[model samples]
Target: MTDPHLDLAARAGVADERALLSAFADNYRAIFRAKVAGLSEADARRSPVRTGTSIGGLLKHLRWMEQAWFQRVLADEPNLPDRPAGEFFPTNEDTVESLLAEYDAQCEISRRIAAAHELSDTGVHHNLGEVTLRWIYVHVIEETARHAGQADIIREQLDGVTGPEI
Candidate 1:
C-alpha cells in the first residue's frame, strides 16, 4: 500500500517538454501500479487471457519496455544484456514488489534521459530506423496506458477492482 512516489500533481508545475512527457508516462505507470496494489505475488501471476497477460507479466514487460526504449533506443547502447527466459512472465524470483520497484526505478532512469536531451534528440530504434525522445515519450504513454488498461481488467477479475484508482 505504498503511495506512488511521483504524484500526478508533479506535472502541474512542470513547464519543460521533457518533464511534461515524463509526467504523462509516469502517471500511467503509477496507475498500473495502483491496479495491482495489495495483491500477493501468486495473485499477481494469475492470467485471464489466452495470451497469458497476468499482472506480474505485465509489470515485467513494462520494466523491460522502459529499459529497452531508454537504454537501447534512446542511448543506443550497443551490447544489450541477455533477457532471461520468459521475460514477460512471473518466475519464482519475481515478486509484485520487485517488479514494481524495477518499474519505479526504470521510470526514474527514463526521466533522467529525457531531462538530458531535447525532444528532437534522435536515437536508433531496434526495428524502426530512428526516433526522437518526443516520439519515445508519446510511445511510452500509449504503450503504458494500454497495459494499464489490461491490468485494470485483470485486477477486476481477481477482486472486483475496476479502475486504475490512482
Candidate 2:
C-alpha cells in the first residue's frame, strides 16, 4: 500500500525554491484539513482548549489568512471582507462542510495568485512594508504548520485521532 502521509524530504529535494515552499505549504494545508475530517458539527465547534480554538475556527481563520496574503497582499485586492469579531471562533452559521469548502476555495485562489508572480516579486504589506513572494510562502508554511499541529492535538483530544491522516 502507498504511504499516505506527505514526504517532506521528497518535497525538500526539489531544486526550485518556489516548488519546495509551495509543496510544504500545500502539505500542511492538507494535513490541517485532514485533521478536521469526519468530525461532527458539534465536535468541530467544540472549544476543548482554554483558548477556544475550535477546528471550525481554525478552518475559517486559515481561509482568511490565505485571502489576506494572496488576494489582498499579492493580488492587490483591497476590498476583502473584514475578519469576524470572534476571529478564531466560527459563527453559528458556519458548518464544518461550509468552512472546509471555503478554505479549499481560498487556497485555490492563493495558488493562482502565487503562480502569477515570481518568487522575487515584491508586494506591499500593511505593516511589514515591502515583502517578497518568497517571504510570503515561508510565512504561510510556518503559520499553517503551526495551526495544523494544534489541530492534530485538538482532534486527538476529541476522538483520539492523531497525525495528519483522515
Which of the numbered candidates is closest to the native, going by highest lDDT?
A: 2
Compose the digit string of candidate 2's lDDT tens values, residues 32-57: 88787789999989878998988888
Query: What is the Cα-based TM-score of model 2?
Result: 0.92
lDDT of 1: 0.81
Per-prediction TM-score: 0.87, 0.92
Q: Write the residue-wise lDDT of candidate 1 on 1-166 in tens digits.
A: 5555447536447567766777778788878878877887778999878998799998898888888888789987778775666877988888888888988898888787777888999999767989998999999989988988888888888888776444
Off by over 4 Å in 2: 1-5, 8-12
Q: After superposition, how far is residue 55 of candidate 1 from its true place, in Å?
A: 0.4
Clash count of each predicted structure: 0, 0
Error (Å) of candidate 1 at residue 84 is 3.5
